[model samples]
Target: MPIKESRMTQSQNVQLLAVKAQQALMAALRSGQLRDGQFLSMSQLVTMLGLPLSAVREAVKHASSLGLLVTMPKRGIQVMEARPETIRDCLDFRMVLDQEGARRRIANDDLTGLGALRDRHQAFREAALRGETGNTPDGPIEVDLSLHDFLAAGLGNAQLAAAYAANRMRTAIIQNARPFLQDRIISAMEEHLAIMDALERHDADAATGAIRLHYTQTLRWWGVT
Candidate 1:
């Protein structure tokens, strides 16, 4: 291979490894293998992520950029702690994205997956009522994030979508520390259904209102005053 081509290949390979490392880090966070506010040395992070130092460094840079992790001089990396202020700020950013998404979704007259979304929320609601927590096909977290994910992606703005996804990982980190309250699952489902109803009716105002209401309840549930 030409020298330039070889260099390009090497760069591409590095990027791929870095991407995998970032994904592994995220998985570790989700699975509680890496807890919020936990600090780890460079070698420790490499061992936990099971990747080489170079790739882990890249991953750390990416994660740090997203505000998910912080690197301190001689103190190792610290995962973002889910304080009340942090929770409030994260939720506030997401609320703006969701509200805009709701308006855009209604304005575009898009109700393509409304039925399926409603079905999932309804199923969750019923399962919660029956005390069958494990019955939902995708579990409560997936069901809860579906509508918001849909609305956020519908905006067709790549940057905002990326920001939304990053904030989701932030949410996961917070949940890892304070886990979702099962008692609130039913209430969440009901709130989701209300938003879906508004979307199906093509009422932009109602949809945004429902989204706002859901956020309000969620903040309370998270104990964020």
Candidate 2:
């Protein structure tokens, strides 16, 4: 069956299409379908995403602005190599924003969103414990990103939320570098559970502590700290 278009404005349609294309490209890149050093032309992206050329162009521009892709004059767009310095900078920025978000969440006495985050964390933990690989390699990465996104949304800061969304590719790239292990995954889940507990208790001190510890461990995984 053919899909029918909704009654959305042209701009709204473009934005929605761009978002879909961006997500599709990110998924491909994370799964190794679009490998590092592989250059993709606009035509290729259009075909891959089944999107309009304009939508693909806009998505490419957005990704490039986010530092996920680099364009060469004649060579087209290639995935940027995951560099340590870039990863460190991204982690530092994310940590600062996330810590602020946690602090605010605690101060505001918000625990509603924390439950969902905890649930996802527990699911990932159980999957890791059973030595079961997720349906996709990006599964754990998506969970980790969701935790931060939930916090950012709870914080109610538009700017921080935008920044966090912009860094999605960088987060994926960093997570992709780490080896998936049961023990490591379990530890990460425990860390997330601790943070969620703190949030649930509205304990700013404990939440901040957990965030610091989690980031430290994550950096270690990337050989950064």
Candidate 3:
């Protein structure tokens, strides 16, 4: 039993390493340590992050899947250009989904169950004030995908939620491919809080408007507008 437990723990540790590797890579991309048209070598990554080669490979695979990184035979992993159309499409998709999500949540009177959401936003704000990157768990590449995930899934419409999640993942990668300015981040945080407040009040129009504002501000930040 002890041996089995030890193996399980080792497996967990490997998974954790992979997660950390992805987070580290995201932070690097966000900080411009990696950029579009830049080439990445696995050996270099392993040395840089002090992680096992296999774990770095796991991270590379994920970034490739997101279309943020690609392998060219001679060039290894090269960062892909995040095209303007790509960013615009992502923003457009999110605006539609989030607007609809707000409508459904408000119509269904979901405020009672939003306590957890409220707590999460509050915690994140407090963490920000404390000079901690409270969102490190998901990495900077993705700005709170779970928050949008919650909105998408909140209405209990499985199909809508699935589509939103798919787009959200892609959108997040593009957003995180470049560095975000502090002012833009603060504006987004406020927009999110406003959306949450509107949702809690069951004000569909207000919530929808806030959602649009959030996406518009985000797109503007990404130079989509």
Q: List CA RMSD, all candidates.
A: 2.1, 4.8, 6.2
Local accuracy of candidate 1 as per-residue lDDT tens digits, 1-225: 999999999999998999999999988876678889999899999998888899999999989998999999898999999999999998888888988988888888867888988987898789888888763323777778888898897777999999999999897787677555557889989999999888888888998899889889989998788
| Model 3: residues with Cα > 4 Å off, grouped in runs | 1-80, 134-143
TM-score of each: 0.92, 0.80, 0.62
lDDT of 3 by residue, 1-225 (tens): 699999999999999999999888766665556765677677876787788888888988987776767877765777766788878887788788878877887887766556776666656555555657544334323445545766777667777766675566556557657655444445656777888898888888998898888877777777776
- Rank the models by TM-score, top first: 1, 2, 3
Error of 2 at 152 (Å): 1.2
After superposition on all CA atoms, how large is the RMSD of candidate 1?
2.1
Regarding TM-score, does 1 or 2 come out ahead? 1
Our tally of clashes for model 3 stands at 0
- Which ranges in model 1 have alpha carbons more than 4 Å from their true place? 1-6, 134-138
Residue-wise C-alpha lDDT for candidate 2, range 3-48, written one tens digit per residue: 3435346558888888988878777766666665567886887888
Q: How accurate is candidate 3 locally (lDDT)?
A: 0.71
* Superposition error at 9 for model 2 (Å): 9.9
